[model samples]
Target chain A: MIEDRPLIYKYLRHDKKFPHVWCGGCGIGILLGSLIRAIDHLGYTKDEVVLVSGIGCSGRLPVYVDFNTLHTTHGRALTFATGVKLAKPELKVIIIMGDGDATAIGGNHFIHAARRNLDLTAIIVNNNIYGMTGGQYSPTTPYGQRATTAVYGSVEHSFNIAQLAVCAGAVFAARGTVYHVRQLDGLIEKALLKNGFSVVEVISQCHTHYGRLNKLGNQIDMMKQQRDSAVPVEKARKMSPEEMEGKFEIGILVDREAPNYLEQYNKVRQKAKNALSLQLTKEEKEESERREALDKQ
Target chain B: MHRRKKPEPKAQLMQGNEACAEGALIAGCRFFAGYPITPASEIAEHLSYRLPQVDGTFIQMEDEIASMGAVIGGSLAGVKSMTATSGPGFSLMQENLGFACMAEVPCVVVNVMRGGPSTGLPTNPSQGDVMQARWGTHGDHPIIVLSPSSVMECFTLTVKAFNYSEKYRTPVIFLMDEVVAHMREKVVLPEPNEVTVIDRVKPSVPPEWYLPYEDTSFGVPPMGIFGEGYRYHVTGLVHDIRGFPTLRQDEIEPFLLRLFRKISIHFADIQLVESFHTEDADLVIVAYGCTFRSAHRAMVEARARGLKVGLLKLITIWPFPRRVVEPLTRAKKTLLVPEMNMGQISREVKRVNQGMTTVLTVNKIDGTMITPQEILEKIEEEKK
Candidate 1:
């Protein structure tokens, strides 16, 4: 078999200490599968891409696929990813994280990176609950779910992932869930190919933790809820919020062209080139040497 | 003695911070990001004036983390880069320093250490961060930190810091005191041609074969330009040498051990020191940074009084120079440690002693330098 062709639906054999502590039938694997397919479709040589993640179930993504991996502090993956993008604009930089890791702990960085339109893709495997640290309530946990922190039904309204991305100035934003996994993979491919901050928020399952805690029914039932809940963004515009409440939005939310961060920062560099040329002239050299001798004495 | 060369003229009287900024430029630093904080503010102020002269970018970031972040980013872009701050701001930069370590990004961080835990004596002299420079970020990572004892050392070490940062693919600490940061010492900077500049290792292979974390023959991977044809990933994860994230027990174990041993294997080359009056010495005193000034005076005075005493001042603090201190501690009957902080280096001195000799500490945490009289007094007490 050609090594370049990725066999879809095959178990990923990469990260050893990983898929750690996530409950059975967790949606992380599904999102991870889509990410692999997207990269496969893009034909990114594994060595040429860099994946950065912060702490949390989703943030643990850097562990799985063999790319240049960075697992930093919570909510800090984007900041580090920005460094990677700014440093090496040729690198295929991507960041993967969970709901709380991105919108919660990493909210400020997320917005700022979006505003800058950095040349990187952000795939938020938002499974709703904080699955890594014992099923705690996350920023994206639905308003009516029960979590460790929110022992009673949650009162805080959930953030609409696509809307948040748009408001944050994301050039490419979209939503996909585990049930619509194949389309999710396609969205990731599109985001990876696009310039600037592209966000694909995959609505995933958390059967062992989130589903069990909130009494959101069995794994199959939770899967059905996600499938039934999403409405297409174009259709949602026509339908009322009431009609869109229980429907999933399955395609691109915001896709447009914008100047990426490194290209813009390079403008300052171009301007600096002239100043450097003048500073390094021969006359300036003799002057600096004479100054050095006097200072030494 | 060799014939004296003609004395060249002093172009301008620049502050130490100005010299540091100029030195960074001559060393090819094209990116400088910093936030204005006490004592070290002149560094940011100077960079603002000098970076424009060389067409380099000077950004006043929101805080120290972002400043250090930008420096690391800039270095990855194949630009020499640095950030400067006092202790308070240095604390804020600890997290990113760890990021630089885990990802092996090269950059310089000039920490003009002042007295305190949280905003302590921002304008005063204190060597409180000598230990923090080695062990600040949480983890068992090996670090190389160079301490600049004089204003001239500050300028020279700032350049050296950038060189080491680029060469080793690690963050090099320029641990300066407030006194050194603010002091106006005449610094004669070399012309850009006279000084050697080291750039980050660029990938030599075609973009397809180049992994950003794949170490070239130099034991450090050649970094890729972000916008170029290279398409490798870089992560802070314990990855295979190829630069991707991994969780194979095979991957994690080796990744961690390599992360630590890479520098440890090269410890001797990373060590730096200035030793004096150590031969035939009956008593030896160890110190570093600003305290070396007073320690020098005490070492001279003790010898003048017909007592055998000497000084071992460490310039490269991390890799700790235990080899240098260990022999002296065993050979000399008595050894004393004097520093501006409360017994930080003194603790290390005793640790290396292992009961072969008596190791004592002379600490002063009152935001003042430990005077020669104080160190001499300790030597005098040891004499009896």
Candidate 2:
């Protein structure tokens, strides 16, 4: 018999944390595999990778990875990652957060982190609903989708997270689905190599809570739903407004460059140091004036 | 060759907030994240100007919550980090402060208290957040809180706060009143060598054998920073010795107790109390923060008038300095607490008193300082 272990196994904590908290057949595992493969492909050492997560099913992903992992409070992963990236610009800090954790509770940090444009990778797992909290409605849950909190279907509209990231000044914003495993891996890898704040919103499925509450069949059915509904950005651009209803683009939505936070802060430090060197005391100022007068004479 | 004369060491007039910013730099704090609020904003503003000059990073966060989160993150990344806020902002920081305690991240939080249950007064001074600093964060966790009475103490105590945070792998609260935060006084700061600056202990063992939260002979475990090849996990959840979240009761019980015991066992070094004429006195006033300044004045005048009055100024607020305070409760006839809040720290003084002595409280919630004359009058009444 031939061995069939995956290449990404090198990045996993094999000695401990077996049987992760993610439910069986959940999309989180698929996205986690995509992340691991992306990191493995990038060839960055585990010592240089810092995986930061907020409190949720997605937050639990960092513990399984053999990296410098930090599982912070709900919705504050980006803020903590900001500190890490600012303190040590050499470390590659990757932040993971759930839909509700990212959009609702941590919305301010999410947008601000994008606006700050720190050199950090934010992988937002958009599972539509708060799965760990028993299928409660999240900011990304589609309108008219039934949730545990919204038994009669949600009235509020959902956010287009990739578009929001672009509007919030992220240098690179992309959307990929768990069904598109290869595409997610590429998107995450590209995001990891991006110069500024990069976001890869993974449209994943919470089969146990979200699927059961909305009568969306089972895990495989939801994965098939993701495959059917996702339109490529190239196709999205060519399609008419009327033909693009109930569809989201599944590729890089925005990719551009701006001066990232650390680069700008370096300039500020240089300016401050220059100013300090140029500054003179009262006696020095008086002596310089007297010397100038003497030279004129 | 004409050489210039070296500038003489001199005392300069500096604001309390300015002293705190200077103190942080001297204590090796390289990262600061804060949001602007009244009184405490000066600390952020001064650090914003000073940090970049020292090749340090200073960030103005969206709110106090993000500021605190960033502070903890910077600390975990092997840098001394801090954030400053007032009462309303401090309220926002409680959740993240609790997270820091649970994760044992070393950082400093300075709360320059303004009058408030909800933004009651922005510019006025109040010693109201004393109790909140101890219990604001959810869950039972150990915290070191230092209150400074003067501008010089503000500089010294801010350095002390960073040392305590790093030594214990815990968050230390630097509690200041609006009065102390804004008051300008002549202060000569000590050289870096004069004050002891401590850093967190790192693991001596290799990454394969390192446990981030291992129960050691000393309660505090060596802290490993991120990206140091340790590759350890850090979580806000009740975690085991390996820093991974565990549901086992055996790991959970010791984890909680160690958080408290780490600070408690080192109470001898943690407790800081200043006494003024306490020996051979019938009456003693227990005060802290800016109120201690007034009580000190009252004690001086009372002694001049032949009244045996003493003042115990509590510098360390959190562990309550029970060892020193409990003794005063039994030996002294009266323990007076004059504060700018409605008996916040006085309640602790009473609890430790346990009905052993008369605990008199003069609380002013009208956004005014407790005057020395008011305390002197109280002492006179006690004498009669």
Q: In TM-score terms, which candidate is top? A: 2
**What's the TM for model 1?**
0.81
Supply candidate 2's per-residue lDDT for A235: 94
Cα TM-score per model: 0.81, 0.97
Model 2 clash pairs are none
Worst 10 residues of 1 chain B by lDDT: B1-10
lDDT of 2 by residue, A1-297 (tens): 012145657777886667888899988888888888888878989999999999889999999889999999999999999899889989999999998888899999999999999999999999899988888899999999999899999999999888999999999999999999899999999999999999999999888988998889899999999999999999999998888888889999999989988989999999999888777465589777777666666
lDDT of all predictions: 0.77, 0.92
Error of 1 at A51 (Å): 3.1
- Fraction of native A-B contacts kept, per candidate: 0.30, 0.82
lDDT per residue for candidate 1 within A1-297, as digits (tens), equals 154235532324342444454556778867777788788777887657777777877776655555555666677777667766655667788888889988887787788778888888998887788888988888888898889889987899988777798998999999988888778888899999888899999898887788889778877898898888877778877887677665667789889988876676667566666666776686688866866775677
In candidate 2 the C-alpha lDDT for residue B252 amounts to 99
Question: Highest DockQ: which candidate?
Answer: 2
lDDT of 2 by residue, B1-384 (tens): 555555456699999999999999999999999999998999999999999999899999999899999999999999999999999899999999999999999999999999988988999999889989999999888899999999999999999999999999999999999999999999988877888899889988999999989998889999998888888999999999998889999999999999999999999999999888777888989999999989999999999999999889999999889898888888856899999888988899899999899999898988989999999999999899
